[model samples]
Target: MTAKRIENGLMGLAAFLLLALMAVTGIDVIGRYLFNAPLSGAFELTELLLGALVFVALPLVSRAGAHVEVDLLVSVVPRAVSRVMGRMAAIVSAVVLAFFAWRLAVLGITQVTDGARSVSMGVPLAPFAFLGALTCLVAALFGLMREMRP
Candidate 1:
């Protein structure tokens, strides 16, 4: 899929996840305050949900040019050099993303092998790790395309 499409999907996923988090958190708070009973897994649930939300939204933010860029040299350089530097940065970012994805994949595999599950929800952690890694791969592909484009 195109970078823009991926960005849109990521944004949508993040938004949905954010809404879910809000609902869960709100429910947890209400239960504790009103019922005098708290959710046993509230902390773990929030941590995992927020973590997923952060990772899901990261690439979309990066694609939207929301990430910080330090262009001290690129800003001062000639046009030709600036463009070359931009391409180089894109290439490097892609490489970094690739490495991240690979590592995440390995970690996910281990999680699955170990049969690891979240403390609160009891859902397998591997799926989320894999999804996060998939997003990293998508972002890397986007970066490569950005570099290859005119």
Candidate 2:
């Protein structure tokens, strides 16, 4: 699939996740305060959704070059040097993210092997780890592409 198609799909998923998170939180709060009964496993659901949402958005953020940056050195250096520094930073970020993806993949495998799950909800943790790993890999690719851009 095209990059734009992938990005649009991710964006749609992120939007759905955000809406779900909001709905869950709102329902839980209303239920707790008004009915004295919070939704069961609301916290666990929120935790999982939040984790997924962040990873889902990571590639979008990377593609948009929206990551936070400290420009202290870049601000002082000459334009050419600053450009080089930016490229170097992107390369470094790609490397670090790739390493993170590898570690997450390993963790996912271990979780699957161990039959790991969330405490309250017994939700499988492997899928979340794999999602995180996949997103990090995509974000790392975006970082590498950032270095390629003029």
Candidate 3:
């Protein structure tokens, strides 16, 4: 599939996760305050969902060049120099993100082997960790693509 299509899919998934997180939090709040009872796993679920949402959104955000940047020097620099600086920044970002992805993958594997789970809910954390790693890899690839563009 094309990079754009992949980004679109990722973005959609992120959006869905965001909405789910909102609904889950809202329900938990109402249940706790109004009914004096809360969902058992709501906090753990929200934490996992938030992580997934951010990671899944990264690729699309990078692809769309929507990442926050301080452009104060861009106006003073020559156009060509500005472009080169932007590409260099992208390359650096890609390398950093790739490193993070690798670390996250390793951590995920370790967590799985150690049978790590959420404190309250006992939900498996390895899968979400691995998913975060995958999304980071995708985001790094997209950043590389952006840096390589003519």
Candidate 4:
């Protein structure tokens, strides 16, 4: 319900996804080398999990303003100017991320209409696409929240 609670939930989800990715990769490697049989659709699973993990963690990073930045120009600017620059940067980031979310949602709808599936596993692609869109939208909101702070 609360922002911290939501952030914690996202962190837990990201951690779980990361662990699942590691387990999947390890099992796939062991199966391939020792048993002479790789896990079916391991690559697709990894790709999806990695993508999910990145997006899942994005909102937290945005909320914390923890994104990597080169502040060389900010150091040279007046405090007022630097503050304005930071706000402008946040606005730009939010806009770009929102655009991505919209585009991804559109792509997800298209995939659904086309009955798209993964190459090997035949896994439906629309859900993951929609998940990506949702996370990007949340990240964009967090970016705006960062701009609002102080």
Query: What's the number of clashes in each of the models?
Result: 0, 0, 0, 0
Pick the winner on lDDT between candidates 2 and 4.
2
Candidate 2 lDDT for residue 102: 99
Per-model CA lDDT versus the true structure: 0.82, 0.92, 0.89, 0.91
Clashing pairs in model 3? Answer: none
Quick one: ranking by lDDT, best first? Answer: 2, 4, 3, 1
Candidate 2 on 1-150: residue-level lDDT in tens?
776887899999999999999999999999999999999999999999999999999999998989998888876889999988888888898889989899999999999999999999899999999999999999988777866777
State the local distance difference test value for candidate 4: 0.91
Least accurate 10 contiguous residues by lDDT in model 2: 141-150
TM-score of 2: 0.94
lDDT of 3 at 142: 90
Tell me the lDDT of candidate 3: 0.89
Question: Model 4, 37-147: lDDT tens per residue?
Answer: 999999999998998899898898998989999999987889999988988998999899999999999999999999999899998999888988988888888888778
- Every model: Cα RMSD to truth: 1.7, 1.2, 1.3, 1.2
Q: For residues 1-117, what per-residue lDDT tens digits would candidate 3 score against the true structure?
A: 999789778978988998999999999999999999997789889888998888898888888788998999999999999989988998889889989899999999999999999
> What is the per-residue lDDT of model 1 for residues 1-150, given as tens digits with 9 covering 90 to 100?
666777888888898989988988888899999998887788888888898997897677556656688878976889988888878888898889888889999999999999999876797999888988988887777666666678
